[model samples]
Every structure is written in C-alpha cells, then in structure tokens.
Target chain A: MSWLLDNFTLVTELALQHARLSAVPIVVGLLASISLGWLAHRVRAARLIVLTSFSLIFTVPSLALFVLLPLVLNTRVLDERNVIAAMSLYAIATMLRGAVDGFDHLSPGVTRSATALGYSPTGLFWKVQLPLAGPVLLANLRVVSASTVSLVSVGALIGKGGLGYLFTNGFQRNHPTEIVVGIVAVLLLALSFDVVLVLVGRAALPWIRNLGGTSPT
Target chain B: MIEFVGVTKTYDGGAPAVDNFSLRLAPRRITALVGSSGCGKTTLLRMINRMVDPTVGRVEIDGEDIAGRRPVGLRRGIGYVPQDSGLLPHRRVIDNISVVPLLNGATRAAARLRASELMAVVGLDPALAHRYPAQLSGGQRQRVAVARALAGNPNILLMDEPFGAVDPIVRADLQQETLRLQHELRKTIVLVTHDIDEAFLLGDEVVVLRPGAQVAQHGTPADILADPADSFVAAFIGSARGKRRLTISAQRSVDGADRVVVDAGGYPVGVIAAPEGRLPVADPTPRSRGAQVVG
Candidate 1:
C-alpha cells in the first residue's frame, strides 16, 4: 500500500497510457468493423470470406500477432504502433461477428418497410439500421474494451506494456505489492469501461430499456 | 389509373414470376390481386413503386412510365402497407407514422401533427403516439402501419396482405375498417391476399392469379362468384365447398315476414324478408320449395 502511494504518479501515468492504448484500438476497430460488416451484408459473395478471415485472425495467439505485426509492418519490436496495430486487429476480429449479428438480427420487414416508406439507402442505414443495431454492437464493444485493456499489459514482455511493466518489474525485484497494484489498476480500468459503456448504451438505446414482448392488440 | 403494359418479371434461375401480364387498374377502387404462395401477387404490387422493376415492358401511373421516375421519389408518393406491421421497432409510434411525411420534407412538428391526425383516421388512439412498436399490440401496430401509409397522403395505397397476420376476428374488423376508410378517403387501393373470401369482401374488382402470375380470372366479386370462368376459379373461390349456396329453410309467418337462410352445410347464414306478394326467390336447393314454404 505504501509503495502505491509513494509511486502514485508513476501508477497514474501507466494507467493513462493503458487507457489510451485500449481506447484507440476500440474506436478504430469499431469503425472498420462497421464498414466491413456492412460490406459483408451488402455483398453476398463477400460475406463468407470476410467472416472466415476475421474468425481465423482471432484464432492466432495474441503474443504471436504482437510479434508478427511488427515484422509485417517493418516497425521496431518495441514500437507502440506495433501494439496499437495488433490490438486493433484483435478488436476488429472480436467485434466483426457481433456487427454482422447485430445487422442480421433486426426484426424482419424493418428495412423493407423503410425502403417502401421512401428512405434512401444511405438514410435507412444511418437512421434505422445502425440505431437499431446499437444494443448488440455496444455489448460486443464492452467485451472488446475489457479485453483490450488487459491485453495491452502483454506489451510489457516486449518493453511496451503500459501497466504491464509492474508485473515484470515487481517479479524481478521480488516485490508482490507492485504486481498486485498493476492487477488492481487493470481491473479498475476494465470495470470503469464496462460501467461507462452500460451508461452510454442505456442513454443511446432508450427503446430497448423498457421493452416487453409486443402487447396483445 | 395504373396500367401494367405487358409487364414481365423474371428472377435469375426460375420460370418468370410474372410473364407478359397486363392489366389496367381503375382509379379510386380496390383491386385485390389474390393467389397462393409463389403466385407473384407480391411481385406485381412491388413494381408499382419500382421496388422490383419489370424485366420486360413497363408500369405506368397516370400515363407516365414509372421506370422513368427515381425510385426514392416514386416510393415517397405512394402509400405501402406490408403484411406484418413493418413499423420501426426502435422508433415510437409517432415517429414511425411520420416517416413518410418527414421524407417528403415536412418539418418535424408538421409531420408529427399529420401523424397524429392519421392515427385517428386509422382508428388508433392518440395516446399510443409515444409508445414503441414492441409496446403496442399487434392490432395497434397494424393501425400504426395504416396511419404511416396514409402519412404522405398518396392517392394510391398498396397493401400486401395487410390484414394477413391478425386473428380472424381482428381481421374481419380490419377488413370492415378498410371498407369504411375507403368510403371516406377514396384512395386507389391495391390489396393482395391469398384468401378468396377476403378478396371478395374488400375488392371492388378482384384479380385471381395462378401460380405463374397468369390472370386466371378478373371481375367483380358477384360476377366471378356467379359464373366462374373455369375450374381453377371455381376451386379458388371454394364453389365446391358449398358454403356460398344458400337456401331458405323455413318461413316464420303467414306474410312471410322472415325466413331462415341456411348454407349447404345447414349453418344459418342470414335471414331474409319474404312478404306474401313477392314470391321468395326460388330456392336453388333440389328440395321442393312448396314443402318448405309454410306461409
């Protein structure tokens, strides 16, 4: 406990670094996934290929991806870009399936009705389809956010992990408190993210809040 | 008036859904295109708004070829009600109803005002305006659909089995409401249903279609019922069911003030007046009319 108080600024910096690392990949990956998901849905021939590729990427070990991406991108092993890029790949893979499911699970006839009611294709997607898919997308995003925060610590092995440094440093010095502090910080960050996502979801998707099955007419 | 100028629609790998079908639909009347599944009734309706364009030939609305119109612009000017109440589940009833009006460039307040009025027109309560679709009952959702269809105030309303999903009692009520609404609004309505009874009840002129979108028969309900064009029309209208054959079973008084009319299956369908001077319309039943005519 005294160690955490004494190294408070160091912990704060590491936590901030960890939050940034987790956040960038989530936001970037979400945008990419939405685009790819829409393409998968629109282009029937592309659906199987896109989904299979995303699933395959998720199967690669995270440590291997972290090592492999730097080589592919010609970046230094310790470059933060390597971690960001690799985490983004994992985020996209994790959220891609959810994006597809979100769009696929819309109640039947919704898009048909929107088209019939004079919605332009673009307008329908933004106003109706995207908004209705919000709940599912948010749920998957919460998952990605928590995992990314924890995963960023793996960067420590290659000298880039944010709070992950505490794990290796405390192990080397034989001090358990520093390791516990790192674990506690990551857990707090993930929990806060999950809490914030739930709040945003509730605010954004008001219709799903009090929904009951369609009442009998 | 709408005209299908030898329109034909063919998909990628099957027989043409609608093959060289042409028919002129009268203005301000209900024309029901009825057939069982795979009969292309829905495909025929969608061509009006360019949802599915004809592969060959063209559909014309008021002497203008619809193919020339932009699809979004064309659909905005048309009212469409699908089988399920296709209300947006995420939007409240008011927003769903106002969708077309808003698309037509009405201000938010103006569109919602129009939507509220349309809710009354479709027999929906104004109180349901703020409820989401899932919060409403099936009947209410359908009423919202009807109100939404009317939002743009389009002259032509296309219904693809509008009352198909509701219970029979609700369906009958909705059918009657459709009639009442037609009497008031007089919009040119094209309804599609697989049920011949519904077609006869609601359609001013019913077009019975066969599997390949062939026009098996088209005429007033009475004309088609009285003289079926062929065996296909007969079976479609259930002539073999003997439900339409009514007989005067018993006279109630000396003056023939009332008589019980029963169908072939012995179910009382209706009662009729048969005053003394006016001979009861000859019963089609083979049973001697005199024996049943107690008066």
Candidate 2:
C-alpha cells in the first residue's frame, strides 16, 4: 500500500505513454488502409492479390515482426519508432481487410447508379462509397486498437517506454503488485479506447445502427 | 432516337450473351426489353450507355455513334435505376437524390435544393430529406432512387427491374410514379423486365427478346397484343391479354351507362356492363378473362 502511494505518478505516466503508442499506430493504419483499400477496389484484377498479401502479413508472428523491424528500417537504434512501426504493420493488415470488406459488401447497384449519375470514379469513392463504409471501418478500428494496446508491451524488450516497461521491471524485481498494476492499467486503457471508438462510430456514422439485415433491393 | 446495329456481346470463353441484336428506340418514348433470364436484355441495355461495349457492332444515340465518347461521360447524360434502390445507406435521402447534379459540378447547396424539389416530384415529404436510406421503407427508398436518377435531368433513362424488389402494393405505387415522371419529364426511357404485365403497362414500344438476345417482336403494346409475331410472343403476352383488354376497354368507355366495377373497396377498378345486356361473344367457345382485379 505504501509503495502504491509512492509510485502513483509513475504508474500514471506509464499508462499515458502506452496510450499514445497505441493511438499513433491505429490512426496511421486506419488512414493508410482506407486509401489502399479504395485503390484495390477500383482496380478489378488486383483485389484478390492485395487481400492475400495483407492476410500473409497478418499471419506473421507479432514478436518476430517487432524483432525484425530494426533490421528492415536499417536502424540499429531500437526506440519508439520501431515500436510504432511493428504495431502499425500488424494494424495495417487488420485495417486493410476491414476496409476491403466494407467496400466489397456494399450493394453493386450503388456503384452502377453512381456511374450512371456521371460521378467520376473519385467522386463516387469519396461521396457514396466511403461514407457508406464508415461504421464497419470504425468497428474495425476498435478491434485493431485494442490489440495494439496489448502488443505495444513487446516494445519494452527494446528498452522503449510504456506500461510494458513497468511489467518488465516488475518481473525483473519480482514485484507481483507492479505486474498486476501494469496489466490492469493496459486493460483499462484498451477498454476506454474501445468505448470512445464506439461513441465516435455512433456520432460519425449513425446510419450503421439502422442498417437492418434487409439491404436495399 | 437510339439504335443498335448488329450488336453482339460475348464473355471471354463463354457463349455470347447477346448475339446480333438490332433495334431502334424512338425518342421521348418508353421502350421495354422483355425476355427470360439470360436472354441478354440487360446486356443490350448496358450497350446503350456503354456499360458494356458491343463486340461486333455499334450503338448510336441520337444518330451519333456512341463509340467515340468516354463511357463515364456518356453515362452522365443517361439515368439508370437498378432493381435495388441502391441508396447509399450512410447518405441522407437528399444527398442520394443529388448525386448526379453533384457529379455534374452543381454546388452542394444547389444540388440539395434540386433534390428537395425532386423528392416532391416522387411523392416523398420534404421532411424526409435528412433521413438516411436505412431509415426509410422500401417504397420510399425506391422513390428516392428515382429522384436520384432524375437529378441531372438526363435525355435518357435506363431501368432494370426497378421495382422488382418491393411488395406488390409498393410496386404499384412505384409504377404509377414512373408513369407520372415519364409524363412530366418526357425523357426517352429504356426499361428491361421479365414481367410481361409490367412491360405492357409501362412501354410505349415493347421489344420482346428471345433466348440469345434475339428480337422476337418489337411494337406498341396494342399492336403486339393484337398481332404477336410468333408463338413465343403470343404465349408471353397472350396469358395477360384478357385482363389487359379489360383495362383498355375500361379506358374507352364513354358514358353513365358504364358503371365503374370496383373491388370490395371504392377505388375505381374497371367498368363492367349490366349482365342483362352483353356483347355477343365472337366465338361460341368459352373465353378466359385474364384480367385480375387487384385491390
């Protein structure tokens, strides 16, 4: 109890760090994925190839990805950037798949109608397609974000700062209280982020709630 | 006028969907392409807007070969309504209706205003402008789709089973809406449907396509009903003629002696003369009245 009081500020700082690390990757992955997914949808022949490649990337083990990042980026320097790069790679796979699924699931009639309406392909993507895909993409963001919170701990192995550092220090020092606190903090952070995403999804895309099973036509 | 000269479309390594199809569509008229599934009626319709390019021949719109124009540009001047209302679920009803005008470079505010006007034309309340597509009923969605198609005020409209997804009651309402729009807009419309009754009701000119995109018959509804080119057309249209004839005859009635025969409800249905005085049957054989009195 006395130790908890002594390290309260330190724990909070670690929690904040962990959150920032998770957030940066999720945002970057989401934006990149949406753009790439739209490009894949436009090019008819490339859809399967792009999806398959992303799926392959997702299959790679998370730890291995983190360990290998320093080599790929050509930096012996192991820091926050490496942590972000590894988590983002994992996030990209999930996000890309989500964006692709969202777009593909849209009614083909919408595309046909837009085309007939004289919408340039670009106009159609931004106005008709992306807005319709909003809810699904945001739901995907929640999943990827939660997973990212847990994965960032692996960055601690490279001496980066986050809750993972707390967990590592607890283990090295054999302090069960610190380990429990670190784990709890990560869970709370993930849960809070998820709730925020749901609220954002509802506010940004209210249509998803009313999208009943009966699709148009 | 729209003309298709020996248009043939063959999918890779597959049999031709449309083979040597040739026909002309008169301006400001409603022409229906009727056929069984896989008969390539849709393929032929797609050719007109260059959605599908013909493999063997040319499609001309207003006497100009459409081959030279970019497909995206060509599609802009043509309205297309699919079986599904195809409303973007996330977009408000007004935005969906404004798609064409927005695409054509109209400002957002102006496009929205036009959409509001079109909503009234399609019998939707102005209050519905802000509602998402998912919030509306099937009938309303279809009306919004029709409004969207009319956004650019195109010279031609293409419809493929536009009301096939709705309930019978809703389908009737939508059909009436289409007729009303056609009357007001006077745009050349090419509609494709497998339902013979729909073809008969909406088409100023009906072209019946047989298997492999063959044109079995092309004529006005009365002409085709009066004289079907072959057994295929006769069987197709003949089954519905009894009820159809009643509808036509009802329109021709001129007096108070003609009592409007309605169903259980008070809605004007058809005219039936008193049984005491009846026109003699041309044939002594029993004839079936194919006309069904739908409520």
Candidate 3:
C-alpha cells in the first residue's frame, strides 16, 4: 500500500498508457473490420477469402506477434508502435467475424423492403443495415475491448507494457502488492470500457429499449 | 399503364417462373393477380419495378422500357407494399413513412409533414406517429405500411399480399380500407393474393393464374363468377363445389321482410330485403328466372 502511494504518479502514467493502447486498437480495428466485413457480405467470393485470412491471423500467438511485428514494421522491439500494431491486428482478426455476423443477423424483410423503397446501395448500408446491426456489433465490441486491454499487458515482455511493467518489476523485487495493484488497475480499466460501450449502444438504439410498450395516443 | 410484353423470368436455368407472361395493367384501376404459391405472381409483380429483371422480354411503364431506367430511380416513382409491412423496426412511424420523401431530397420537416398527412389519409392517428413499428398492433403496423407507400404520391402502387399477415377480421377491414383509399386516390394498383375471394372483392378485373403464371382466366368478378373459362377456373373459384353459388331462401317473419341468401350447404351468407308481393317459395334457380338477389 505504501509503495503504491509512493509511486502514484508512475502508476497513473502507466494506466493512461494502457488505456490508449487498448482504445486505439479497439477503434481502428473496428473501423477496418466494418469495411472488410461489408465487402465479405456483398461479394460471395470475398466471404471465403476474407474469413480465411482473418482466422489464420487469429491463430498466430500474441507474444510471437508482438515480437515479430517490429521486424516486419521496421521498428525497434521496444517501440510502442510494435505493441499497438500487434494489438490492432488481433482486434481486426476477432472483430471482422463479429461484423459479418452482425450484418448476417438482420431480418431479410427489412433489407428487401429498403431496396424496394428506393434506397441506393450506399444509402441502404449507412441508413438501414448498419443501424440495425448495432446491437450485435456493440456486443462484439465490448468483448474485443476487454480482450485488447488485457492483451496490452503482454507488451511488458517487450518493454512497452503499460501497467504490465509492474508485474515484471514486482516479481524481480519480490513485491506481491505491486503485482496486485497492476492486476486491479487493468481489471478496472477493462470494466470501464465495457460500461461505456453498453451506454453508447443504448443511446444509439432507442427503439431496443422498452419494446412492446405503447406511447400515448 | 404498366405492360409486360412477352416477359419471362427464369432462375439459374431452372423452370421459368414467369413464362412469356404479357398483361397490361390499366391506369387508375385495381388488378388483382390471384394464384396459388409458385405461380410466379410475385415474380411478375417484381418485374414492374425492376426488382427482378426478366430473363427474356421487357416490361414498360407508359410504353417506355423499364430496362432503360435505373432501378432505384424507377422504384422511387412507384409505391411497393410488401407482405410483412416491412416497417423499419428501429425507426419511429413518422421516420418510416417519411423515408422515401427524404431520399428524394425533401427537407426533413417537409417529409415529416407529408408523413403526418398520409397517416390521416390512411386512418392512422397523429398520436401514433412517435411510436416504433414494434410498438404498434399488427393492423396499425399495416396501416403505417400503406401510409408509407402513399407518402410519395406515386401514380402506381404494387402490393404483394399486403393484408395477408393479419387475422381474418383485420384482413377484411384492411381490404375495405384499401377499397376506400383506391376510390379516393385512383392510383394504378396491382395486388397479388392467393385468396380468390379477396381478388373478387377488391379487383376491378381479376386475373386467375395457374403455375408458371399462365393466365387461367381474366375477367370482371361478375363475369368470372357467372362463367368460368374451364374446369380449372371453376375449381379455382370453388364454383365446382357450389360454394360460390348462392340461392335466396325467404324466411317467414311478422313483416315477411328479409330473404336469406344461402349457399349449397344451407349456410346463410347474408340477408337482403324481401321482394314485394308473393315469390316462389325458397327459389333455387332465381338467376335463370332473371330475379337474381345475391352475388
């Protein structure tokens, strides 16, 4: 407890770094996944190829990925870019499948009617399909966010671990309290991301709330 | 007028869905296409809006080949009501109704204003405009679908089993409402239904279709009922079972004022005012005697 108080500023900076590492991959990966997923959905041939590539990418171990990214990206092993790049790849590998499932679950009637009612292809995607797929998309995003936050801790092995540095240093110094603080901080950060995502989903999709209840008429 | 000239639609080299079907839908009138499932009625309807392009031949609106027009632009100028109402569950009723107007570049306020007016025209309350489609009853949802179709005020309306999803009682009310709306709006409407009775009641001219969209019989309700083209048409209309053949049976009352129209099974169809003076008791063949009382 006294050690945590003494290192409060260092702890805060590490926590902030962890938050950024998690958030960047979550946002960037999801955006990239949405486009790839839509392309997979619209073109029959693209579905097989895109899904296969992502699945293969996901099977690659995270530690190996973090170590290997620096070489492929022409960056130093200790650079933050290697950690961020590795996490972003993992995010996309998971989220691309989620995005496809989100779009696939929409009712055929709604999409058919949209096309028949004069929606251009681009207009239908933005105005109808994507909005309807929000619940599932958000659910997948929550899972991805938590996983990304935890995965960033592995970057500590490469010297870029945000809060993960505590685990390595605490082990070397034989200090269990430092390790516990790091674990607690990561869990709290992941939880906060989950809560924020849920709130965002509810705000964006009002019709999902209070279903079957009638308004005054 | 919408015309299908030698139109034939085939899927993946299989049997033709609509095989060389040609029919002109008269403007400002309702034409009901009555057929069992797989008769290609839906395929034929979709071809008009270019939802499904034909494997052979052409469809034209006012003699202009629809193939020349972009499907999105063509569909905007024509109204389409699908079987499930197809209201966007995420959107409020006003938004669903105003979708097309907004797509066509109307200001949001103007589109919503048009939506509100259509709600009144289709017998929907303004209070219901803020609700989501899932919050409304099945009947109300269908009314919203009809209102949405009319929002653009297109000259043509294509309805594919628009009332088929509701209960029988609501179906009857919607059919009546549709007739009333048609009387006022006078748009060219092509309604697809498997129910022959619905076709007879709502269609100015009903086209009975066999499998593969063959025109089994096409005539006014009265003409088709009175003279079926063949045994298939007779069976399709249920005339072979004497279900559609009604006979007037006068029941005695203190005033002797009501005659019951009954089918062959002796079920009362409806009551009509009794004819003046004595008539043949429970006349069975009134139509040949030129004293028909029921249709």
Question: Could you give the fnat of all candidates in order?
Answer: 0.78, 0.67, 0.67
Q: Please, what are the lDDT tens digits per residue for candidate 2 over residues B230-271?
A: 878877875343433333133335553454554333345566
Query: Where does model 3 sit among the CAPRI classes?
Result: medium
Each model's Cα RMSD: 6.1, 6.7, 4.4
Q: Which RMSD does model 1 reach against the true structure?
A: 6.1
The models' CA-based lDDT, in order, is: 0.88, 0.81, 0.89
In model 1, the fraction of reference contacts reproduced equals 0.78
Stretches > 4 Å off in candidate 1: A213-217, B251-256, B276-295
Stretches of model 2 off by over 4 angstroms after superposition: A35-63, A212-217, B239-295
Per-residue error for B16 in candidate 1, Å, reads 1.8
Worst 10 residues of 1 chain B by lDDT: B286-295
Better of 1 and 2 by DockQ: 1
Q: Given the true complex, what DockQ would model 2 score?
A: 0.50
Which is superior by lDDT, 1 or 2?
1
CAPRI quality band, candidate 2? medium
Model 3 stretches astray by more than 4 angstroms = A213-217, B277-295
Tell me candidate 2's TM-score on chain B: 0.84
Clash list (residue pairs), candidate 1: A155-A161, A156-A161
lDDT winner among the candidates?
A: 3
Question: lDDT: which is higher, 2 or 3?
Answer: 3
